[model samples]
Target: MVGTALGLSLVLLFLSVPVFLVFGLGSGLVAIFGLNLPWSTLIQVSFGAVTKHVLLAIPLFIFAGLIMLRAGVARRLVALAMAMVGHWPGGLGVAMVLTMGFFAAFCGSILAAITAVGSIMLPEMKKSGYPPAFSVVLAASAGLLEALIPPSNAAIIFSSLTNVPVSQTFSAGILPGLVLMVLLIVVVMIRGRAFSRNERAGWGARLVAVRRAVPSLLTPVIILGGIYAGLLTPSESAAVAVVWAAFVGFFIHRELTFEGVWSALKATAVTTTVIFSIIAMATFLAVVLTYTQAPQHLTAYLLQYGIGPITFLIMVGVICLVLGTFIEIVPVFYLTVPIFMGIALTMDVSMLHLYVVFTAFAGIGLLTPPVCVGIYTAASVANISADKAFPQVPLFVGVGVIYGVLMIFTPWLAEWLPSALH
Candidate 1:
């Protein structure tokens, strides 16, 4: 059954079938013919996979991001970021990275973050003489921070699957998120010359920028504060984010329109549907893998070789990087985590540390090619193509590799905050 399913999936993938269909059909074939399972089981798993109440956060965060985009929130954040960093060498690049970090905190969706911030910053970077290819890569790479920050769908999903506390999983992301932000800032500084033509903003200008940005800036504070203070669950905070964004965007800012709100709803629906479809398909594949004992057999194979923790982590990183090139994170997570978490637990590895490493590599995958969602989204936003942006991805991917290695050796990077909060 396992070999037949694997062969069918590989063939379908090579034939250019969409990934969700590949997994769904490949697994469904094995279940019906190879293993003789009832077709009704697949339906049950597919529907059950997406029924979590916490998963509501994904669409809400996405909707909030869309509303913010329509309300000119991205523009306000960019202005504040430029006022803070745009006077320095490669300052426009720096501003892109910084603003992406802020946007990531609110949306926790990489494509949304890249689309919103990229739309605003990429053009300014190009106008300031930044390379079009480099600008797209920068914004896309920075947008990967969304995978690590609080309110992240990936983190939320990880918690749901592994039985980790959602709040601690959210906390585990904060330090590494900051590290990635700083690393990107440094990369921009090293890779580019001073691009911004704007002189340093005077104190008055900076104050005005802050005033203009205040309403938009409250988003992260409200979301994070509510989550961290025990005042709201991640899902509830997401709900609050939707309402707050609508109120601020439509009322206080006076930029959002009824038409724009309708559009945001439509976009959110489309985004939500795409994500849920992948999850449902992947869940069916996961059920097949679990029943076939693929994870158990794989774990035994690795343990027989006396694989140590560091080497095991390296292997996981390699697989994620390769898979990420052609698959979305939802499928990747469903496919790999079941195999890995079992192995890691047998080795007494810290679940927090293991998951952080997993998520970080997954983020890097978003920066890789072929299936690089972040890069493609940013490129489209900039009216460019993947080939134009491909050259700059390697350096950013290397930094992600280094960060993954750091997470392996320094277990505290993902554990300390969660422990402290407890």
Candidate 2:
């Protein structure tokens, strides 16, 4: 019965059903018919799933991201980046990577990171004679740091699916995000030979840039600082983030207006609705998986078939990589994350290690060839053909793989900050 339901899901997914229905139609029905589970229980579970307090953080963060997007927050961060790196050879590249990492901390989604940061930096990178392909690819790939950075929507969703604390997941993602940022900057410098450097900003200019960016920079400090310091639950931190973002956007930046906030609220509604739908369906599917003992049986079957933890981890990476390329990263997550819990439990892996590391791996799919979402997003932002960014995919994906290998050896990288605070 479990195998049949799983197979049905694969077929329906290929046929382009929405993920929620894929879960409901395939797994939910199997539990109903095969196991005689009641639809009432499934309905109750789905309703309860969307009620998580931590989930509140998502919509608030989304609203904050939308406000930041409209307020031109990226420009200030880019100014700071330029002041810091603008004089160095290949400084534009350094600035771009740094801005993406920083903005991701303030902005919630990769879409905003790439759109806001890419809109500003791509023009500069081009004017500096950075290879067009390199510029677009860099924006698309490095922009993924938003997912690995704190205040990450990806981490929140992963936590929701796995019942992991949102704060730990957010904290766990930091080292990987920072490592990837450093690696990307190095790659940019190596490729920076042809790109021209900007005139160095003097101390006065640097001070002005820093002064203008101080308010923007403080958003992440407030959000993550409160979470790490245990002064705020993830939800409370998110609410505080919303209030702070509005304050900065309207009063300090003077770019965000009432119209912008209304628009952001509308956007938040749409995005949250879609996200909660997926979470609700995933909750139901999880119940179905539990009812059928699929996760348990699969773990036993894998062990019986001689798969060790090392092999299991590799398989998880490959699955995320492949699915991430073809599917949006979130849906790839919905399909796999719940099933992995049972397998993750049998190993010595912490949920933080598994989720953070795999989130990075899933990000690679967006950066990989063929159906690369990163390339497409970059292409759209650069107003260039997708093929232009294709060649740069391998180099960025290679960096992600290297990060994965690092995580495999140094679980502490993902776990330490969370532990230190715990």
Candidate 3:
């Protein structure tokens, strides 16, 4: 029965069915036919799943992210990053990493960062003699930080599902994001030695860049800072960020137009709908799994096989990586969480730790092949074939996997900040 239901889900996914249907129909059928649940069970669980307050943060963050991207927030921040690092050997390489990290601080989506920031950086990277594959790979991989940083919708969703505080979930990602940043910096520095370095910007230019960026730079601080300080909830912080982003767009930067806000709203609506549906359906499936005692059985199976926390986490990485190739990032996240969370409890694994690692692996999914949306987006922005970019991905993805294992060994890398903040 388990195998059949899993097969149904995979088949529906392969047919390009909507994820809501994949979760709803595939899991629903399993519940009804295999588990003897009534059809009404689906409606009850799906509707309940979407009602959480933390879910409110998602659409708000998405809207603010879109507005900031169009308002040239990435442009100003990229300038500041280049000014800070452009004189160093392989500075553009380092600059790209910094730009992605800085962009991540404002924008919360990896695909958006890849598209918006990559367009700005990839061409310069090519002009500066960086390899095309290297350029796309860097943009796609560093783009992961967008989802890892504060104001991350991914973190917001995880917090909602797991009952963790949103601020703590956001804080948990800080060190791992920084550690990955340093690793990329080192790799780029060595390989970047072969690429041409830009002439250092004059102090006057640096000052101007900093002056222009200061308003945009305050964005992450205002959004995440308020949350950490306990002055605002995640939803409230998102609301404030949206207003601040629009203010910067309309008055400060003057690049954002009325049409941009409208488009951002429409896009946010569509994205929010899709994400909410996935969450709803995933919740339905989790209830179904519980009814069938699947979690207990799976836990017993793992223990019977002598699996421990380390092995279980490694298995999870493998599972997420494989599913990510076929499923979009959000659906992959919700689809796996129910199953993983259950078994993780039995292993004495930290649920918070499992979630942070899960989110990190989702980033790698964007870099993984066949469905590497992150790479394709970066490649398109770079005007290179994704096939050309594929060869370069393994190294970055390997580093990411290493970071996942590192997080496993050093759970404190994710847990410490969240705990301290509490």
Candidate 4:
């Protein structure tokens, strides 16, 4: 029954069926054959999935991201990053990485990060003589950082699915996120030298740019700082981010208008609806998997084959990497984390450690090919071919693998900050 469901799901996915439909089709098959379960349970599970309190973070975070993008925060951030790094070898590339990191901290969605930052930076990089392919690659690869930062919808969804503490999941992501950013910065420094033709500006101009961006930078501080300080939960932080972004983008910056707000709100509604639908469908499928004891059966088979914890971890990573290349991060989190959490617990892995491993692996999916949502987004914004942006996949994947290994071996990298806070 497990084999039948898995095979059918993969076939559906390959045939370009939407994820929710694929999940529903697979679950329906399992319900009819594997277990004489009532179909109403599927409806109940789908509805219950969105009723999760923690799941509130998803829409709020998405709204915050859309608001910020519509409000012109990305432009301010890019200007500040360029002012700071534009004189360095590969300064534009450095600016791209820096801006993406900043945006990720607040937005927490790769598509948002790529679209917002890419629209602003791609043109500037091109104007500065950066190769269009390099610009597209930088934007697409940096989008992966959105998954590793706090307030990330992926982290929220993963937490909801696995019943892991969302705060710890958020904290566990910090170091790994910074590490990935640093690795990307290094890559840009190496390849971006030829594009850094601007003269170094004096301290006065740099300071001015910093001052100009201070308000924009404060969005992340307000969002993450409020969460870390225990003054707010992720949902509250996301709401605060939306309010703050509105304040900064409208009255303070005078950039956002009524029409702008409406547009952002509409975009948020569409995105949230799609994400929720996917979550609901994935939940129904998870119910089927649980009812059939497929996870237990699979785990037992792996153990029977002498697969150790490390080998199992490697296999999980490989599977996520493959799936991620073709799927968006949130749905992947919804579908896999529940099944994998059971296996991880059976292996006695720490929940914190497992969260890190799963998230890092899932983050890889955002940059891989076939689906590569981030790459497609960046490519579209930069007016470059997705094929042109493909080379950066290996580079970003290398960074992701390094981060994943760090989380696997030095679980402390993910656990320490959360532990200290507790």
lDDT of all predictions, in order shown? 0.84, 0.83, 0.84, 0.79
Q: Candidate 4 at 260: error in angstroms?
A: 0.8
Q: For residues 298-366, what per-residue lDDT tens digits would candidate 2 score against the true structure?
A: 888887998876678788888888878766677778788888877888876788889876887788877
lDDT of model 3, residue 290: 77
Give candidate 1's TM-score. 0.96
Give me the overall lDDT of model 2: 0.83
Compared with the true structure, what per-residue lDDT tens digits does model 3 show for residues 1-422?
65667789889988988778888788788888888887687778777779888888888888898999989888898899999899787798788898888877767667877887888888998998999999898888897787777778778877776787888888888888888898889888988888888888999999999999998889999998898888999899989999999999999999999999998889888878878888888775777777877778888999999999999998888787788777776887777777778788888888778877887777688788878888889889999899998889889988888877787788888888888888
Model 3 earns a TM-score of 0.96
Candidate 4 residues lying further than 4 Å off, grouped into runs, are: 304-306
What is the TM-score of each predicted model, taking all chains together? 0.96, 0.95, 0.96, 0.94
Can you rank all candidates by lDDT, best first? 1, 3, 2, 4
Candidate 3 residue runs with Cα over 4 Å from true position: none
Cα lDDT tens digits for candidate 1, 1-422: 77788689879987989878988899888988877889899899888878977787889988988888888888888999999988877899999898888877777567878888888888888888999988888887887788888778888888867878788988899898898888888888876664545699999989999999898888988998898899998889999999999998889889999999999999899988888888888777777787899889988998999999888988888888788787777777877887799999988887888888888787777778777888888889999877889988888888889888888788898999999987
- Report the C-alpha displacement of residue 281, candidate 3, in angstroms: 2.4
Candidate 1 at residue 78, lDDT?
Answer: 93
